[model samples]
Target: MAPRPPQQKVVTLTDPKAIRALAHPARQRVIDELYGGSVLTATEAARLCGLTPSAMSYHLRALEKWGIVVRDEAGEDARERPWRAAAKDLRIDHSGHGAATTAATRAFAATFVAPLVEELLAWAGSDRRGQLDGTSMSRGRMWLTTEEAKALVDQVVALMAPYEERTAADHPEGAAQFSSFWSLMRRPEGSAAD
Candidate 1:
């Protein structure tokens, strides 16, 4: 296969309301399932996640209220309302959420990270583990001016763009769901010259 193109940074909402809306585990799973090209009814989604139909319905309603998922009007069944994700990818702006992290936010982050760790372990057990062969994994200190830091982030984002776009479609039949979490943090202790 040919190489994928660079990704475009597309983060629609930078508001606390949107971030809080997606903080729930059930809602996040709904987003994941729908993003995989499955416009499913409440019952179908509930079965997929082992949730009760009524519980799934409540979560679906919450997602709809937040404009993250929308009813699939193109479907024919009136009793069964199918839904799809509003965006193919979501980027949460943590800047305005406030300095102090709430228990709810921390819990949500832990829930999200747990599944990711599980998947990485499972992936390592499989034969395709060699796919990470050429990939580099390391941490190091860096000193960069404001412009240089921004440019570096842009470059990394660009490189990951195409893979992000094709992530859902690239999975084979009966493949387990995989989640990718990308984050960049800057500490105050380090100066630009550091």
Candidate 2:
């Protein structure tokens, strides 16, 4: 399963600075690992992301400043503790307007959404997709009032909440990690909600 918030706290970020900080490709990769059940020290994360320890420390600090990640409790000797994702889910609210914000928002979208698209394309072209039993590719649109849309998203979130607390070891046999992304967005030529 994809990363789910342990406490069902899906952080909605409207701060451009925070978004910008998170949009770095290496930082986003590190965040994915942390969220996906890796509690990593700076050195470990650096090795995972192909950065030097100091450079990883810089990225980790930027994420820490935004509360996107936090250091776990220290060892007995006060060595650099491992870091974990502060939230399982992150939503970027791109309601801000400005050139810098626009750039940041674009970068954020690329970092998060590109992998989904790439994975889907690869799956579609491969024989493995035919062997899979539970893969899902769903897309549809509805004319929902804004309030109704919010309610729909809430229901979906609630559906996911129970899975949040499960660990890899707790998973049943034959279970595999899944990657998915969902979005509800208006079409560019969309009319006002009915």
Candidate 3:
């Protein structure tokens, strides 16, 4: 037998129910556990997330139904089935969905985004935060043609590809997770309704 790859390439979510299901804190933890191609049984996941096994099982089942997680066929057991994330990362596009879905997406985003803000604040307050850590953040406005904006995003993703493909074996020591967030949107001003 051979080993599976370290990660699945990607999974995109457009279904509102799936997005809403993922919005819950506990389920988000479950998804995080399975990131980077890791697999875990409900019991193991529950322990990590501080949830009861049954509660974790319920969340896993919901994720499974949404195709966000799947039974780890190689590790499946009659006693306790294991699961893995369907992709190394998820891409969500709800622009095609209606207002309710947009609202749900906002709520889902807050679940993760708010924590990132707090984490940044905590790090900034701590002595361990070093100026040379390569962490950078910024906000600015740009005037660009639609084509130009698309090209900018493509360049950003290209720059991130190598880092995103890394595995623990690549570093072998002191490896850690890093996060980045970006969005490019047109201002609501000057629109017809406005």
Which one wins on TM-score? 2
Candidate 3 TM-score, C-alpha based:
0.80
lDDT of 2 by residue, 1-194 (tens): 23333443666778888998887778988988876666788998999889999999999999989888888766554678778888777678877888878988888888877667778898889888877577888887797888998898889878876665455756778877777577788666646553
Scanning candidate 1 in windows of ten residues, the lowest lDDT window is 1-10
lDDT tens digits by residue: candidate 1, 39-155: 678998898878999999988988777666777754555778677666655555555546433544555577667766776787679787777544334556666777888798789
Q: Write model 3 residue lDDT over 1-194, tens digit each, in one string.
A: 22245346777888887788888888877786576545788998999889999999999999989778887754535688778778766777667659878877988988867757877898889886876666777887888888998899779777877776565445437767766677787777786644
TM-score of every candidate relative to the true structure: 0.68, 0.83, 0.80
Report the C-alpha displacement of residue 59, candidate 3, in angstroms: 0.9
Cα lDDT of candidate 1 equals 0.65
Model 2: pairs clashing at backbone N, Cα or C within 3 Å: none
Ordered by TM-score, highest first, the candidates read: 2, 3, 1
List ranges where model 2 is wrong by over 4 Å.
1-8, 76-78, 190-194
Look at candidate 2 and tell me the lDDT of residue 137: 86
Most lDDT-accurate candidate: 2
Q: Model 1 clash tally?
A: 1
| Model 3 clashing residue pairs (backbone) | none
After superposition, the stretches of candidate 1 with alpha carbons farther than 4 Å from their true spots are 1-11, 97-105, 124-141, 167-179, 188-194
